[model samples]
Target: MDLNYSPYDFGIHNDPYPVYARLREEAPVFRNEPDDVWVLSRHADVQAALRDSATFSSVNGLRIEPAFWGPDAERFFSFVAMDPPRHTRVRGLVSRAFTHRRVQELEPRLRELARAYLDPLLDGEPFDLMTDFAGPFLADVISELVGVPEADRGEVRRLGAAIMYRDEESTDLPPEALQAIGALVGYYAELTRERARGRRDDLLSGLLDAAEGDDRLTLEEIVGVAILLVGAGIETSMLTLGNAWYAAWRHPDQRARAFDGRVADWIEETLRYDPPPQALARTTTAEVELHGTTLPAQSRVLLLIGSANRDPRVFPDPDRFDLDRDTGSSLAFGSGRHHCLGANLGRLETRIALEEIVKVVADYDIDTDGLRRIHSTNNRGFATLPTNVTARR
Candidate 1:
């Protein structure tokens, strides 16, 4: 085992695909100290582990550092911490909300919301695509879905950013941040009770009804799932939006093809090339052998989802972002039992955002001078992207 690459101290935050490529080739399962965890870099290994939940459990929580969960770490780590029957039960209930009918119903409204934000941002002068458009677009959509008032959306965005910070040193959330999470949880809990009491016609109401039996999700579970859904929704979708715009501006030919119904494929390529959730953690429930190394029970396995997506074994010319190439099963969304229940919703969000942007904004350029990455091990995205966009004349 050549002990050369420093997985913890990866300097190239701007472009980490190269590092992931190296890890996949040399040490498929690399160990690092910054987070003090073992990273699985190969696609096959990560995929297998994701599918085999019995060996690799989500119980220890998905974050590398415990602080990523902030104050509600214990009280809110339900959906992400459950295994087997419990995991299936909770996920199934939430899955009902995002079913084809519900999401399809939400599409027209979602597109209207996209246009509402996009048109304002597309006014004459240069605007930051991320702050002015992507961020607000996603934040607003999630807010509307969870019954958040339009006025409170900013505060929600603020707290969401603070709580989703990736840098291990970012635990100092202002009082308002805590309040934001509490308010969100309180709102959802009340909404859950309301849906339970009176048969409402919304998705939240359906989830509330789903929590009735012995396998019923607890109030805490309801709050946790709501928080997870809302937080995860805004962050990842916004990241995809920003990344897609960046990818398009960088590749002119690709952008043209992307506009022609190939944006979904392009988004898939972007995810494989540079996913928002760069890496994920799973605690081993039993001794497991991966790549000739014996991982003891309870040992944490850090799946480098971005790395796996770029593994040469799985994708030919893995580094190249070819929209036509059928890159098999990228772990942009997690695999197996605990896979993202909001996968379809996330895709719809990204697709609609791209469609709106591509149609309204003609010329674009990345303002690399001030771009910043969110500081979180669990979620990878930009905090501030100072880009200039020209609306179609």
Candidate 2:
């Protein structure tokens, strides 16, 4: 069977699992010549590559797009696009500010934010979950964390959305997206400067104060970290919340179980079954052989995270969204040194949002015909999910 896969293809974005299944069974090391990328579909291959970051480097960024791929990828992805000493140092500094305590401290505020955004929507009117709730909720959370003023949060969120968006089957960043990037960077740079002057009880101030002896983050690094939060933090969490909501809506039994306070399971199952990050790009450091195919040094590789999560070798009944299944092996937040630093915060946000939702929503139905999927290079989620909910009596 002939195999062809392009992450930029809208067809693939619509439903990549069937193609992923075929690639795993037929072409474990599938190559897409048009995109100039090698696709790794098997669980073992993807997991191994993630662990072996030395050979599968992230220096060129975790994307195949010309604009996002290259040595200067650090401009957009921050330390996540760096390797070795650079990555270790930058990540360590950021960690001092982005501590577990910081995330845990947000719990009370997260619940408050969840209810603040979700409460009004329970009046039984149809609302787009993405726009009405998920989008704004995450905007508030990240903005508050990073010290983005409440007045600017809406615009910041809009810019964040523009940066992640792609046209149908588009291969490169659009002009508007580029502008949005510039705007966001400028916004963060100014914010970072402000925080340096008069500190606040927020991550931005914390970042300014974060130091390793005499070593501290540079202005550009702090701005980059803030941009990374907008790019990685907001979009992923918003999409995850929408994905989980849609997943449960599709499966009645699972939906019922989720409503019965299985909110954490709901989040985990949604993450495994339909993770936001479908693929992660890596550049091969040296020649490598896998599945009888040799990948050349510097070749672009797309580790199909969505595919790996569904590999039967790792997950039984892979397509079934069962909350009972162990989802430990899922690469939803990725793995190894480059593993998502915001994983805990993302989960916490989703949990609180959904928990608040379950409290008010007795049952709900998605307007399937009206559902709109966001076209993106790496993320998979809805741009609009219209729904009507039955409020609890």
Candidate 3:
């Protein structure tokens, strides 16, 4: 059977697993010439590529889209698109401010934010979970962390969403996306300057003050990191929440368990079953031979994270979403040096949101017919999930 895979395809965006399964079995190192990408679809291969960053570099941003790829990728992905010692230096400074203690301290506020949005949605009427809750909640969390003023957060969220979204089958960024990027960068650049003058008790202030020895982030670097947080941090967390909600709605047994306070398990299984980051793009730094095929130097490669998570070799009965199954090997947040810096905060936000959700929401039903998904080259999740809940008295 002939293999044809394009990440830009809307059909693939809708459900790429079947294609991924075929690629893993038939072409572990599949090459899609149309998109000019080398695909690695096995658990071991993807993991190895992630760990071997030297061989599979992130110099070109993590997405294959024309707008996000190449030398300027750092403008969008920040240090995530860089190789060491640049990546090492920038991540170290950012880490100083984005400490574990800081994330841990936000729990109370996160819980409050979750309930603030969830309370009105419990009026026994159908609502779009993405619009009414997940989007706003995660946006608020990121906004609060970044010190985006309360009044400006809605526009910030809109800009962030525009940057990640794609028109069906499009390979490059649209005009609106470009406009959003410019606007977001300007906004953050001003915010960084504002904090530089007088620090506040937020991440922006922390970023301004974050230092290692005599080194510090420049104004442009801080703006880039802020944009990265808005684009990568908020989008993935928001999508993950929706993905988790949908996964539970699809499986009654898992839904029941999740409702019974097994939210962490629910998150793990959902991440394994249908992760938000379906694929990650990398650039091959040197020639390499793998799976009986040789990939040339500087070739664009896509590590199929979604496929790797479902590889039967790593997880038994991988297709099934069992809350009890161990998901320690899942690459949902990636691995190695590029392992998500915001993983702790993402988990905290999700846990708080869901924990509060399970309190007010005894059970819920999703309108499958009304479901709509966001189309992007890599990310996967709903744009609109029409839902009705059975509120708890």
Clash counts for the predictions, in order: 4, 0, 0
Give per-residue CA lDDT, model 1, range 68-87, as digits (tens). Answer: 43323534456766787777
What TM-score quantifies how close candidate 1 is to the native fold? Answer: 0.90
Model 3 lDDT-worst window of ten:
163-172
Between candidates 2 and 3, name the one with more favorable lDDT. Answer: 2
lDDT by residue for model 2 (1-393), tens:
567888878888889999999999999998888878999999999999998989999999988778888999999899999999899999999999999999899889878888998888987789989888988888788987888898898798788778755564465789999999999899999988888889999999999999999999999999999888876778899899999999998899999999997999999999999999999999999999997899999999999999999999999999999999999999999999999999998998889889988998899999999988877667899888999999999
Instruction: Give model 1's clash tally.
Output: 4
Model number with the top lDDT = 2
Worst 10 residues of 1 by lDDT: 1-10
Error of 2 at 272 (Å): 0.8
Quote each prediction's TM-score: 0.90, 0.97, 0.97
Model 2 CA lDDT for position 311: 96
- Enumerate residue pairs that collide in model 2: none
lDDT of 2 at 117: 89
Name the lDDT of candidate 2. Answer: 0.90
